[model samples]
Target: MTNVERFLNQVRQSSLGMKRLVVVAPHDEATLLAVEHARKELSIDAVLVGEEEKIVAAAELAGVCLMPYDVVATYGDSAAADCAVRLIAEGKGQVLMKGLIDTSILLKALLKKEYDLRTGRLLSHVALLLPPQGHGYYLLTDAGMNISPSLYDKQQIIENAVDIAHALGNDNPNVALLCAKEKAYDKMPATLDAVELQALNLAGDITGCTVSGPLQLDLAVSAQAAMMKGCKDPVAGNVDIFVAPTIEVGNVFGKALKYMGGYVYAGVVVGAKIPVVLVSRADSEQEKLLSIAMACVCTTSIPMEAGRMMPEMESA
Candidate 1:
C-alpha cells in the first residue's frame, strides 16, 4: 500500500475513542451513508443534528438504523448549524461535519462570537487529490473558501497546508507556490509574497516545509520541466503540496486534475483543534469516508517523536 493508504488504515485502527463529532443535515443521502460507513468501520461517532423527522426518514430509506445513535432536533439549516456549533462549544462534540445545509449557513454560525472555534486568520478549504496517473498526491488549497486572499491571509493558508504536511510525515514538504511565472517581479505582488515566504522558511519562522514559489504548473510537477527551465531548486520537482495564488487558481487546479486527469481526492479543513472532514455533496461516499480517515491520521501526527531525522538542506 502507498503511504496515504497506510495512513488511512492506521487511522482506522487508532481513531477509536478519539472524540464525539456532530454531523449537521443528516437528511442528505450521501452524507448519511458516509457517516454510516465510518461508524461501522472507524472509531468515530457522530450526533446527528437536523430536522428530526426528515433525518430519521432519510436514515431509514438509506438503511441506516438510528436507534443506537442520539439525534438532535433542529428545524432548519441555520438552526442545525447553530445546534452543531453549540454542541462543539459545550464539549459534546469535537468537530462539525457539513451535510444538507448550505456552506454559508455553517460559516455564519462558525463565525459567531460564542462558537469559540474561530481563529483570527483567514478560513480556507483545502483538498487533497491522488490518482492512478499521479505517482503521489498533490494538494489544492483555499478552493471552497477564501475567494480572495491577501498576502497576509496567504501566509496563514500556507501554515494550514504545512500542518497537514507535517502530519503526513513529510518534514520539509516541497511547496510549489503556484503562480503564472517562475521569477519575482515588482509588477506581481504574488511573486513578492512567494519570495517572502521562502525567506521565512529559511529563518525558521516556517518550521515544517521548504517552500518554492512563482512556479507555473508545468515546472512544479514535472521534473523534466524543472530540468528544461534550469531550475535547480529542490522544490522545483517532487513537490508534495501546491499553494495557489488565490482560491480561483486552486479551485480550477483541483477540478481540472480530477475531471480531466482522473484523480481521486479527499479533503479536510485544517487549523481546527482537529482535522475537519469537508467533502462536498458531489463527493463519492468513498471520498467522504477517506477524508475522515485522513483527518484521524493527521491528528496522530501532532506529537513530536524523539530522534526523528529532519530533511537535509541544500545551499542555494
Candidate 2:
C-alpha cells in the first residue's frame, strides 16, 4: 500500500471514536460524496452546513444518502461558514472542513475574534505527500496559506508542520528549509533565514525537530545528491518536513509532484485550535476522504500546545 493508504488504515484502527466533522458550505457533489465516505469508512460523524435545498440536491446528484447526517440550514456562503465555525467554537465539532465555499470565506469565519479559534500563532497549510517511490511521507508547508511570511511566521509554520508530523507518529522529524542554493548568499534572504532557523533548532529554541537548511531541493531529498555535493548534514537526505521559502514555490513544487511525479497527497490547515481539512474542489473523493482521516488523526493525537517540546527532548 502507498504511505497515504497505510496512514489512513492506521487512522481507522486508532479507535479515535466517532468525531464530529463540520463542513462549511457542503453544496457540491464531491463534498457530499467525500463526507459520506468519511462517515462510512472513517466512522466520522459529519454535520453539513449550507442551504438545505442545495445540499440535498448535491447529495442526490452524488447518490449519497444524507439521511444519517444532520444538515444545518444557512442562506449564504458566509452564513454557512460562520455557522460551521460557531459549531466548532461551541464544542459541537472537533474538526472543521472547507466544502464548496471559497477558502477565504471559510477562513474569515474561522479567524473572527468572536469565534476565538486563533491560538496566537499564524495559521499555515501543510500537505502530506507520498512520494512516487518512497515508503514514507513528506510534509510541504505554507503552500496554501501565508503568501509571504516573515522569519517569525516561518518559525510558527515549522512548529505547526512539526505538530502534524508528531501526530503521524514521527517524534523527531527532520526539517529542511528549502532554498535555491546550498550556500547562504547576501542576495538570497531565504538562505539567511535557513541559517538562523538551523541555529535556533541547535540551541533548543526550536524543539522536537532537527532543522537543516540552505539546501537545494535535490539535496534535501536525495542522499546521492548530498554525497556528491560533499554535504554532511544528517537531514540533507532524510527530510520529513520540506519547508518552502514561499507559497509559489511550495504550490508549484507540490503540484509538480502530484501531476508529474504521480504522488498522492492530502492537505490540511493547522496552527489552530482544531485541524482544518482544506482540500481543493478538483481534489478527488479519495483525496478528500484522506484529508478528513488525516484531520481526525491530528485532532485526536496532537495537543493544543503540540510542537512546543517533546517530552523526551526536554533537558532536565
Candidate 3:
C-alpha cells in the first residue's frame, strides 16, 4: 500500500531525471519553505519569480538561501506569474508552482495564446489521498476546478486523471462516477451523466481505464455496503478514482477525508504542457512540498503503458 509520504519518497529517489521547478511570486513563508525543501531534499533546481526584495525577505524568514536559485524580478504578482509561464513555455522550466499569486492570475498567464501551454483541453485538479485506514491510496478529481462540468468536460477530466494514474503506475485504474444512487434516474442529472460515462468507457470511446457509474459514496468505497445493498459489479469492491459530480461535492469529499477522516494528500493540476503544482494559500508547508513532489513525478519522466510518452507533456 503506497501512502502519500512513501509515494513522495519514491518520487524523490526515482531514477527519472530532475527538472527545474519555477515558483511564481513566492512571497510567503509557506511557499518559500516548500520550494527550498523541494530543492534540498529532492534535488530539484528552482527558479523564483517575484519582486526580488520581497522574495529575499521571505527566504530569510524561512531560513532558505536564495544563492542557489535563479531569481527573476517582476513588478507584481501577476507579472511574476507571467514571467514563470514564459519560462516554462521556453522549456527552461518543466514544472510550474503556485506561490503567493492568485490562482486566477497564474491560470490566465498559462492560457495565453503565446504561452503554448494550452492544448484545447480543460484543466483539472487531481488529489491523491492516503486515507487514515485504507489499504491503498485513492484519487479525487476536479475538486478545485471546473465548477459544474458538462458530460464532455467530465470525459476530459477523467482522461486527465487516467493519465496521472498511469504515471503513478496504475496501468488500468478503475473509475467510479459518484452519485447519490447506484441506479440512474432521469430526475437526477448526475446519475444520467454517470450512465453515459460508463457506456462511453464500455464502448472504448474512452480508453485506458475501466469506469462504472451511478455509485453512491458507500458503494463506491465499501464492499460490505455494496454487498448489503445487493450491488453486483466488478467495480463495486475496487475503485481507484472517484469522479465527483460537481466541484462542491469533490471539494467537500476531499476535505472530509482530510479534516475528519485524518487523510493527507497532494494535489496538482493537469492538462497543460507541464503539470501545475497548485497548493492553497492556507495549506501547510508540508502539504505544499508534497504537491511539489507530485508535480516533479508527473513532469520529469513518466512513461505511460504500452511504451507511450506522457501525452500531456508531449510537444503540441
Top model number, TM-score? 2
lDDT of 2 at 313: 11
Alpha-carbon runs more than 4 Å astray in model 2: 301-316
- Writing each residue's lDDT as its tens digit, candidate 1 over 36-70 gives 88887676778999999999889878888887578
Error of 1 at 219 (Å): 2.1
As a TM-score, model 3 comes out at: 0.91
Best by lDDT: 2
| lDDT scores of the candidates, listed in order | 0.72, 0.83, 0.81
1-316 per-residue lDDT for model 2 (tens digits):
8666777788888665869999988888878888888898888898999999999899989998888999999999999999999999899999998888877777778778777777766778888887667588899997777776789889988998998888878899999999999888989999999999999999998999999998898998889999999999999889999999988888888888888888887888877788888776677777788788888887865445322210111000
Best-to-worst lDDT order: 2, 3, 1
In model 3, which residue pairs have backbone atoms overlapping below 3 Å? none
Lowest lDDT sum, 10 consecutive residues, model 1, at 307-316
Question: In candidate 2, how many Å is residue 59 off?
Answer: 1.0
